[model samples]
Target chain A: MPEKRQMHLGQQLTRAGRWSRAGITSGPAALWLGIFLALPLAAILAISFLTRGEYGGVELPFTFDSYKRLAGFGELGFDSLYPVVLGRSLALGMATAVLCLAAALPLAFFIARLSEKYKGAALTLVVIPFWTNLLIRTYAWQILFSPNRWLTVAAHSLGIGTAGEALYPGTLAVLTGMVCDFLPFMVLPLYASVEKMDWTLAEAAADLGADRWRVFRHALLPQIWPGLGAGFILVFLPATGQFVIPDLLGGAKTAMLGNVIQQQFASSRDWPFGSAIAAVALLLVLVGLAIFQRKGSKHEVLP
Target chain B: MKINTPLLNRHFCAVVFSAFLFAGAAQAEKSTLNLFIWSEYIDPQIVSAFEKQFDCKVNIDLYEDVDSMLAKIQGGGAGLYDVVVPSDNLVPVMMKQNLLAPLRHENIPNLKNLGEKFVSPAYDSKNRFTVAYQWGTVGLLARKTAGQPLPDSWACIFDPAKSAGSFMLIDSVRDQVGAALKYQGHSVNSIIPSELKAARDLCIAAKSRSVGFDGSVGVKNKILAKTAQVGIVYSGEGVRAMVDDTNTTYIIPKEGSVIWVDNLAVLAKAPHRDLAEKFLNFILDARIGAQLSAYTQFATPNQAARAFIKPLDLENHAIYPLPEVTDRLEFLNDLGFKLRLYDEVWTQIKTR
Candidate 1:
């Protein structure tokens, strides 16, 4: 009788746990992800295999010419396009990632060390810039960099003419905007992980006569590895597909992959080519995710 | 589980009810008119007047670019918009796709108010389904010089050494190509590759010199700002700029320029045909036509409206281009599938 009662109680607890987890599942969030992400991705994939209409829209006939064109299968200098665009995108994404990581790390650490009462306020400061539209901010940068603007006047006064010219509408402005926009994405996860850390191990290292550097290296470093890894992935994913910054801040000289794909569909009306480029961008993102997952697992597992 | 059962049922029922309501509303709207056009081109006063006069709802949506408007129409969302404003070149394509309703002249008496000069063009012969709203030519808007010669040819603007990073060209393929063709003393509609190649070469040579490719409005603003000494822009917009700030002067190039006309056409499947016709009639009234021109600062095709304006406004050579200037202009035609070729060349020039 006693054993049977214990089994029934265990079953009830298990059911209650399952119910609680299911209750936390937000219907609106799931629906939003379904409609926006999954539906659009499926539509793009479907359109990519179709032939181009005479007027440059999608036709029903299935063809692989777009992918073949991207591969530069038969044409002269066609193959060069893939590597050129891919190289530029990769360089930009990598630079943005490094900038974001560097800018976010110290800020996140300071937030983690703050009292719980002040932590939210400190974190909110990092996120306030994101509330404003990215395009508006980019345009503001444009205004500041224009020859007629006061920034130019100041630059001339300081003998920084070349730097000011380089700062306005191209690589530098884009990097600045990317770092500003995505730094919060890097910081939040890191703060959460760092705040939840067990400090007892660090104390034990110190009790054993280890110096502060040694204690940090042996005890503190290992715990925060996962957070750093997560922050890196969070910042890297969206930065890879960054569009507005490059379009607004980056001048005509710097055409990112996002700009090219946008032109292919919007102005050029070349769907197959656009889809082919979009497919490449998707594949790059997925590969990045896979690598991040692998790295996370390698560091996180404590056999 | 028991506690949440009603909640789950309520959520499901709410979703089902909302879906049904949306579906019903979509089907119920059988008389709505959807007009998609350029932003700031059409006056809200005109739309409201038509709505009040016709006793029908007027749905006006705006787009930033004409190409984007064409994309939406072509993207199988034709049901989303009933009326669309397309430039002269796109009308034939729209007609070929059977997207337009044949204009019934008897229903629209204001069609007669348009000048004879606008009745026929290269894009649509016989003015089948289109009614000309406003017509303008791409020409040189030069600054008044104390001593320097006023450039009468496109060459002075396209010259690399003289005009690099200082001149403004129209931000469009057809217009840009036309400018290059005009500079070379060739017809704007020349589809000949050798001539096109020459145009492309000229465009490439002018790239380093160009401040940027800008639209008519931007070109006008640049001229007013005195940032751009010369710009290739529509005559009407340039005239408005000159009126706002008197330092600007406009002239049609002696070689040639492209004339562009924006036409108003009703869609074949327009849900609110009665309202659309009423709007057309309202724009056709000479007094209303003059009012619209005043609001939008665009040239009016209504001959009667010209008589109503002051001498200063009428005598502005940019707005009322002289007979010889009008004769020298050519209207752009539908390049058909050759649009892709032109786009590719333009993209290469712009990007490289």
Candidate 2:
């Protein structure tokens, strides 16, 4: 009986030790997320309800004027400016994600099919652009696309653009910049999924009389959906809030949601309004993530 | 295992002694002054010379515009910086907001070297809170096309029919709206709703024809690259572009424009107030002032620095305008609450 009691006490101590170890390992990450993410988000929510001070600071009195202003109801009559900006941002983001996916799908598959040595080299080449600053790269594009440059001359000769006209500061230039900036984000994750794919399953689907498109849809796509979802989120979220690409390439003729929020904070000095915009953007992103997750889980339950 | 009390006490004593030593070293390295100013406005050589003379390190931070600078200062950056450079119009706004500290004239003996016109400027009477650093006028930078005459008035850019080739509007709210107001023969600082509405309409009409809004420096680059034929730019940027390419010219429109002055002032809650005052005095020195003007190619407000300036630069009308040009220039004033009218107008213009 005494021996049994000793073993039980030892087991209890071991269980407590395991619990303490787990707590110690996760403590720092939890603290980091609490301080950096959760606290700032809470602060933004609080500031969105506060009133703007006379000198561009926050005041104690709370009001919903910022939200009202965002909804097209300002001191002036109702206007569709803010809503238009939001819609434009959404369109830009969707276009960028779709373009990235289209370009990345084939490239990722090609990389996955390469020899082991070539695969590493190809991945490195894909990520090499990140070593240089994004601003410098964008400026390089401006130089290349200038009216007097050889590329523009070739484009003009090929009847792609008007004679003596630069191919930048337009929608085409903005789209080009956005796609180039985000392609690697899509390609990396998609490549991971493609590399782990089983060819036997695809062949079996084909042998079962499934056509090319049907095989991909029934067999290959479900396996890679997780990585595709991740890559889509990675590209879409940042592309929506991207300010520099549009400002530089689109010539600032139109303001995106990112630009509007930035102007409120940096130029207008309206913290409350900026916070309101940020809060709304965060809510939109969360809702999108929720819907995506629900769809992804439903796919997982299949087969 | 037996506890070693004496060994643990020795280890604790050694750690405490090292901590004290580190604290002393940190105290010894505390002689740094933080300066926040506009990008490309100050010469690096001048900053290094000041550091050498004072035997202390200087930390520099750059900003692109007045609004961003003010936002940073108001966002709990009060004590983080020792000095700031705010535009003349913003000096009054900052003063009213209690963002600037009063100047201790005794520490800045070089104030006497400033030109008579700038000594007691409207923004800070009797030089109470700020000192003039560099001043320039908003104007047009136009390329010299073969058969087209140079633009002489703001109407050339404001009127779509008269505007030639691809042009760029200034990306600043006050300057852009002011250009339209001046084109209509109204005050650049007009707060009247009807006048502002007319200005907004004019800008929207021009925007349809122009390339789009960009900073003065960006406009200068566009002119140099031959991407644009005309752009609304500051005098300094225009001068720089002309120096780069002789075919470009800077002109102050006949309809008049805004003259702006950037001032160096200490922050209200500065960590190094005395050091900041010394730095200001050093910058105001005659030779240093000339070097600064030469570097930035902007007009100097220092009377004593004239003798030190290069002969060609002193004679350049683009750098230092003639009396006739000066007569047509108006300084931007602090419009107080009326400033919101300009913001509203700018929003409408940008949205359209």
Candidate 3:
């Protein structure tokens, strides 16, 4: 009886140890998320409802005018600028994700196929762009895309643009910058999945009279969906709200959601309006992620 | 091998404890005054010299525009800063908001050193809250290329048919919109709905053909690099660019443009008010004032400092606009709550 009682106490100790261990491991992460993420989110939401002071900055006397303004119900009347800008931002984000995926897939596959000796070097090359500041890289693109530069000269020779004219402050330049900035994000995750791919399954599918496309679709894509989904989210979310890339490369011909929000916080000095726009943008992005996540999980199968 | 978690924890705790002690020691504070002003507006040497003279450390912060500075000050930065440099248009706004502290003339004896024009100016009469730092105009900086003659009229940029090659609009809301309003013979501070809308539409149209909006310095750089032909920029930058690159010329469009006086003022909640007052008086010293203007290439409003200023910089019409130019140029005034009209119109111009 004494032995049995001791064993029961030991099991209870182990139970308590499990709980404490989990707590110890997750405590910092929980604390960090609470402070940086949850606190700011709550503040922004609160600020969104407050009135903008005359000089700029939020004040008391809670108002929904910011939200109303964002919804195109301004003193000037309804205009499609805010809605159109938001739509354009979403479309641009999707385009960036698609472009990143298209570029990363072949690159990742090529790197995965390389022998062990060169694989690390090829992977490092993908990450080299990340070492430099994004702003500097974008500015470099401006120089590269500027007229008389060899790249622009070459592009002109290829009938891409007129001679002696800079190729930038245009959409093509913006897209190039966005893709260059986000390529590593897509490559690493997709490469992780590609490296661990089961090639034998593809061979077996092909041997069972499946075409090359069918074999890839049936065997390989499923194996890589998890990484692809993660990479897509990683690329798309940041691309959606990117201001600097468009500001530098796109020439500010039209404002994106990020630019509009930035103007409010910076020059406009209307923090309430900025917060309202941000809260709505956050909601839109979350909804987008939720939909994408649902679709991705449906396609995901355990390897 | 298994890791020793307890030992690692002990080491981390010890390091963190020491860090807290170091932080506490540092937080005991010093004779430091925080100066918030525009980027590239002040000479670093002037700041260092002030620090040496005062025997106090000066920590500097920079903002690109006045609105951002005002926003920061109002948004809890008031308690963090001692001195701020705001433009003429913002003085009344800051005063009304109670962001500025009353200037103690007794503390700054050099107030008498102000030029006739700067003394008891319209923005803050009797020198109650502000002192003039530097003054300049907003104008066009154009690259004189083979085909692109420099634009003399706002119409050259706004009137698409006579476009002076690819250009960039000034990114500042009031400045850009003001330029557009002036193009249509309207006030830079026009509150008329129709005039404002017309200006907004004009900017929106030009934005596409132009290389988008950029700061004055960026405009100067763009022209210097020959990526663009003309861009709206401030007189100081335009003048500086002219000095460096002869091919670049700064113009005040035939239609009048903005002339501004950037002033030095103390924040209401300044932690080191005495030190700030000292710094203000130090800047007013004739030699130091001249040095500041010469280094920055901005016009000095200090009468006593003019004799010490570099003759080239002092006489340049771009720095101190000619009387004719001054007759045409208007000072941007604080619009109070009505400034929201400009804000809304600016949003439309930027977005549309």
Candidate 4:
């Protein structure tokens, strides 16, 4: 019994040591999030409730007029932002998520299927594009999509409809740019999960007379669901807040919430309203992140 | 043993903490000058010229446009820059906000070289707070070889079928909205909501047809590339484009465009005020002015440098218009609090 107690004490000490190390590692991260993210976010939330100044800065006194303005929109047979910019942001986010998933899945699978020899080369190809500035890549896309440009030129010969002036800046260019920018974000995370997938389970499922699709659905998918969830989170969150691509590729006529927030701060000089809008965007992001966590954990099909 | 242990740990922590503090203090003592200016406007040669002359480290910061520059400056505690080149219209607003340091004109002997016309602009009447570095008017830049008669109006931007999705306009709030207001025969500084609403509508219409709402520099590139047959650009950039690319031509709109002047000002918290003044005076030299003018191809404000301009290029109405043409133009002043209304309207038009 004494020996057992000693063993138990040793186990407890080992666990404590591990916990202490984790606490140390997380200290810098926590401090960073606390200062850079949490503090600014709290200020933004506080300011959003305040009145907007004439020059668009925040007024000293508090006022709920901004929220009340949104409330007034509810009486007009719609949620203030329904069928407006928010709705468009949501629609664009969903389309971008779908597009990113479709592109990322194949690339992740191909990299995962590599015989452990060419994996580094293939993964490097995926990551190397990200090293270049995203805006520069988006601008390169502009050159490609311009009328009579190389991409459109090839499309013309291939009888693709994107040949002429039809390929100019608009929704299509913005969507394509978003897909290109976020594809790697989805792939890297999915690759980590997919590469670690239990190949034996898939083989066992096939051995049991299951077809490829069934094996993929029942065995492979369960192993990679966490990666899919991570990829979805990675792609969905930033796509919702995308600014540069929409500004550069979408033309001035098509703007997102990011553009609106930027205008509020710079052009409007209305930090309060900008902060309010930012607060709302932050809330939406938090809500999204919460839903993502719940869905990710709840749907884990592990044995 | 336990007491000794805590004491030793505390001593070690204090030593490490002191080391970091000392390092940080040492780093802070180094003198540095941070200059924030429009991208490509500050000639790299000038920066190297100053660095070589002064031996004091100069950090050159470039901003894509004025709004981004203002955003950083107004953010308070950015500590990222010491000197800024803001437009003339911004001078009054910055002065009213106490964001600028009063210039010591005596230290800057080149202040005398600035043409009297630039010295007495409404934004800074005495030119005490800011020194005018470069001045240009908003004008039409068209493709010369494309055979489109020089566009003398902002109407071309609003006319879709012709200039649709192939033209550029200044992305700035004052210039973009102000141009629309001028085109509609309304005062550019009108605070009246109805006139603003009209300007907003016209911009929305114009944006629907525009290839891009870009900076003055980008518009200059568009004109050079011939990707855009016409652009609303700075007169200086327009002149440079016409000179560099034979296909490009510039014309001041008959109705008029927003004439802007960029000024060199010391920030209120400028730590290197003496250095800032030295740099300011260096650019004021007539020979330096001539070099900048030759490269940028803008109208030189220095009388001595005016003779350096080729006669044909000087006669180009787009580069240096006749006196009568200059008479019809107006300078943009601080819009004050009305900037918010313009931004809100611009956002509505852009997002919609």
Candidate 5:
């Protein structure tokens, strides 16, 4: 009877240990995401299907009208407004991420190649912009691009813009502000990978009669694939949904997806529609991540 | 065996810290009155004075536009704020939604100070649910260069042929869209899809040619900086801008535009209803009303307060437009369900 009782006690302990191991590691994160992330996402998805309330809140009678409206179907007819906006945002996000990648690659390499003593200082310089308020920095850009400022004056002299006019409230300025804001996100991740890269592999490729392009494609790229993908996402998603930089730097001529989402929630009071826009954006991001995980993150040689 | 003790400790700390924060928030101040209104609409001195008189803390929250204000109230913020200042057209809608609590006549004795005309506005007749706070028209704020004629109509912003360079659409949906609607000779609250479509097209075309949309103050800044020649702005901001720099002027526009009365009312589920009424009553006082008007540069509805108001403000044509201009001005009507038309059009204009 003592042996049987001991065996039963051991069995109970074994079962508890299995759960405790998993429960301890993932329990907090699962619970945290379940309540904060997953639940809100579920609620947004639910609300997206519900009808818009008369008072500009959500109500009953579920419909896909929001998604339909998003797909360029409006009461006035099939206008390209939403689709155009989504396309514009996609372009902005893609452009910003590509620009960041172009800017960050060399800078990341430069920082990683810096003597040990200068590495921290260079990294700090990259991150100093983060310390300042984004709004303030954007305003500073506005001032710098003002007619009185040297940059705009120089641009005017160089025949880029009219004399006595600000260089901002335009697309170029928006892109500049976006690049400035997101460059750090791109650089830090890239620098981490670039620093750990085995330079010998690149040298070996070159030594074997491979050109510089081949060396980078075969040796360097495979090493930094994770960082490049991470940085692209880190920049792209936020850039796509970003309203502030576009609002401040770009002329408020056209609303980005973020601005549209804000309008729906605020002035439009169409919470259900807003939720649909948001849910779509979220779904797009998830789809993008999945695609990137499958294809973009894989080590590939340029064929 | 490896242990995750530090990770465990970090998570434990986070839990305790969050719990502490919750406990601290639960012990909020008593006798606190939350006032929700347009930014810079209220005078800080009056707020402080009221706070001292009632031995209570007044928390002020600001909204830039009517829709945002309504959105907040309807989005479970009904029980959060004690008082909210909403525009005239919104009163009927708020009433239908049960967003407002009828004023307790006994609690707000200072309602007597309101002008006869203001006492019973069409939007909130009999002053049942709201008290008139201020009345003003939305108009063009233009920087009149020495050589150029000032922008004198909604056409200045909305019409391509009559375009003033680099104009910004004001952030308020009703006011700016109302301007466009007026320019097209439609009612400011026109629910007709075709008319709204016309207005929407005009706005989008103008937007591409002009500077983007901004708040009234931002528009004023654009005019002042000469980055923009004209912008849509509220009467108060327009008036203030005119004073700050003599080169600028505010006008009611040739086609006429929205004339709105912003009213103060307690939320139906106001957490501090009693205090909200007190705040309303205090606002209605002759001296306080005049002070509020002088600071905001908007027209005061307090009849008794007029004697205390600055004659300079009273005489300003922008504050009180001419009779002929008043003849054409329209008050925005609550379209109820038809508001969706404008909403869709606005979204189109914005996104496009």
Candidate 6:
């Protein structure tokens, strides 16, 4: 009987060891993703299939009505309003990401080339704006872009906009806010790649008689491809769902997918519809990431 | 002897004792009453008074719009807040969804102080669900420039030719659409598809020539800052803005406007139902009602409270509209399933 008890104790110790190993490996991550991400996503997916109740709550009996509404079929006939908004949102997001990348590439290189002391200060400057609330910063932009402000006056003098008119509540202001808000996201990641880049390949390209553009295309671009991909994804995904900048700076004259989803949840009180929009947004982001990954893999054979 | 059982037992007893103490402390902390209300709608002094009288904590939470308030209560906040203030138009919606509890009228003897019209409102005809807290009108606020005439009609906003200068449209769906409806000689609460389409078109046309949409407070700020010459705003905001800057004046359009009443109601599954009922009763008291109106600059719906209100405030026509003007105003009713129609129309207007 003592031998049997000793064996049982040994088995319990083994079980405990296995559990501790698993806990060390993937426990916190699994628990976090399970609670915060997976559970909410599952709830949204389920809600997307449900029907809106008489007074805005969800009803149990499943329906595909929300998806149908999102597809532009509504009580007022086949309206393409939602589809138009979605297209506009995608265009705005792509524009913002492209603009950020264009600005960040040079800025990232400049910072990466700085002395260690200056490099820390430069990066700190890039992140300092984040310490202030985004809303307050956006409001500051509104004041600067007002009709009588110096910025608007300068724009008018430069023949960019009509005299005595605000330069905001329009596309220019919205784009400016989006680019300013997302530039850091692109800069930080691109700087990481640039800082680690080797200069020998670029020198070799120049030695091989390649021009400046060719040197960047073949040698420099490949070295920073990973960071570019990371920065692009970071900016593009959040920019796609950006509603606040457009709402505040662009005067809310038009609706984006984000704004529409928000309206469904807040103003319309239709959670099912909001969930459907969110589900579609998630799918679109996943597809985008997949395409990006495929293109990125092709560049992985770089020297 | 090897185990040290007495020492282990003492440690275990201490842990159990502390756990009990924590549980008791948590029970003692239950005196907090959670109140969900509109921002700047209550008097802080009155809240402190209620807290001191009851010897409990009053935790205030604010929401800017009715739909957001409804969303919170529906999305698991029903039991989190003891009391909520919803607009009259939303009372029926809350009632239908069972988000609000039936008020115990006997527990609230101060209900007799309310005006007869508000005592049995159309939204809560039996007075079963909600009690009126304050009432206001949605109207136009125009900056009184040196030479510009004050806008007395909705046409000043809807028609570019009639506008004195750049104006702002209200961002809220009901108020903006209702303004358009009233401009076109339709009821502010009209749910008819054809009428709503016309209103949407009018709003879209107005959007082209105006500074875009904003909340009433935003419009008031714009007017105060001289950024906008005119805008649709709530009467209370207009009155307050007029006080700050004597250059702005509010007018209920000759075509009429929406009269909205915000109500204080207990949640159906409120954790502190008795305390919430007591709060409702306390707020309904004549002096408290007068104080709330004085602080918020909104017209009280309590008849008895009028006796306690300052004569100057009672005489302010902007706060208390004339009977003729009040007759022109219409209250918005719950659209039920037709609400989707308004939502669709609003989306079209915004997109256009």
Quick one: best TM-score, which candidate?
Answer: 6
Off by over 4 Å in 5: A1-17, A300-303, B1-30, B163-166
Per-residue CA lDDT of model 2 for A91-192, tens digit only, reads: 899899999999999999999999998999999999998999999988888888888789989988999778888888889889999999999999999999
lDDT of 3 by residue, B1-352 (tens): 1478888898999999999998887765447989998999888999889888777798999898887788788777889999999999889888988999999999999998999999999989999999999999999988887865667999878998888888888888889999999999988988888898899899988987787778888888988988788899999999899999998888899899999999999999999999999999999989989999887888999999999987887778888888988988989876755676776787787677
For candidate 1 chain B, the 10 contiguous residues with the lowest summed lDDT are: B160-169
Specify the poorest-scoring 10-residue window by lDDT in model 2 chain A: A1-10
Q: What is the TM-score of chain A alone in each candidate?
A: 0.79, 0.92, 0.92, 0.84, 0.92, 0.93
Instruction: Give model 1's DockQ, 2 decimals.
Output: 0.21
lDDT of 6 at A163: 91
DockQ of 4: 0.32
- lDDT digits (tens) for residues A1-303 of candidate 3: 534533443465567767776789998899899999999999999999999777665679998888888888765667767887888898889999999999999998999999999999999999999899999999999989988999999999999978988898888999999999999999999999999998989988988999989987888898888889889989998999997898888776668888888778776677888898889989998998888788877765445
lDDT of candidate 5 over B245-330, digit per residue (tens)? 99889988888888889999999999888889999999999999999999999999999999998888888889988789889889
| lDDT tens per residue, model 2, B135-219 | 9999999999999999998877887678767899999888999999999989998988788889989999998788878999999
Off by over 4 Å in 2: A1-25, A301-303, B1-30, B335-338
Weakest 10 consecutive residues, lDDT, candidate 2 chain B? B336-345
Comparing 1 with 3 on DockQ, the higher-scoring candidate is 3
* Candidate 5 whole-model C-alpha lDDT, 0 to 1: 0.87
Question: Residue-wise lDDT of candidate 4 within A149-256, one digit each (tens)?
Answer: 878888778886544653546787888999998888899989999988889998889999999999988898878888888888888888987888887776656657
The full ranking of all candidates by TM-score, starting with the best, is: 6, 2, 5, 3, 4, 1
Predictions' DockQ, in order: 0.21, 0.40, 0.46, 0.32, 0.49, 0.71
TM-score per model over all chains? 0.81, 0.92, 0.91, 0.86, 0.91, 0.94
Error of 3 at A286 (Å): 1.1
Better structure of 3 and 4 per lDDT? 3
In order, candidate lDDTs are 0.73, 0.88, 0.87, 0.75, 0.87, 0.90
Which of the numbered candidates is closest to the native, going by highest DockQ? 6
Question: lDDT, candidate 6, residue A150?
Answer: 91
How close to the true structure is residue B104 of candidate 4, measured as C-alpha lDDT?
A: 87
lDDT of 2: 0.88
- On a 0 to 100 scale, what is the lDDT of residue B297 in model 3? 85
Candidate 4 residue pairs in clash (backbone atoms < 3 Å): A56-A269, A56-A270, A57-A269, A57-A270
Q: Which CAPRI category fits model 2? A: acceptable
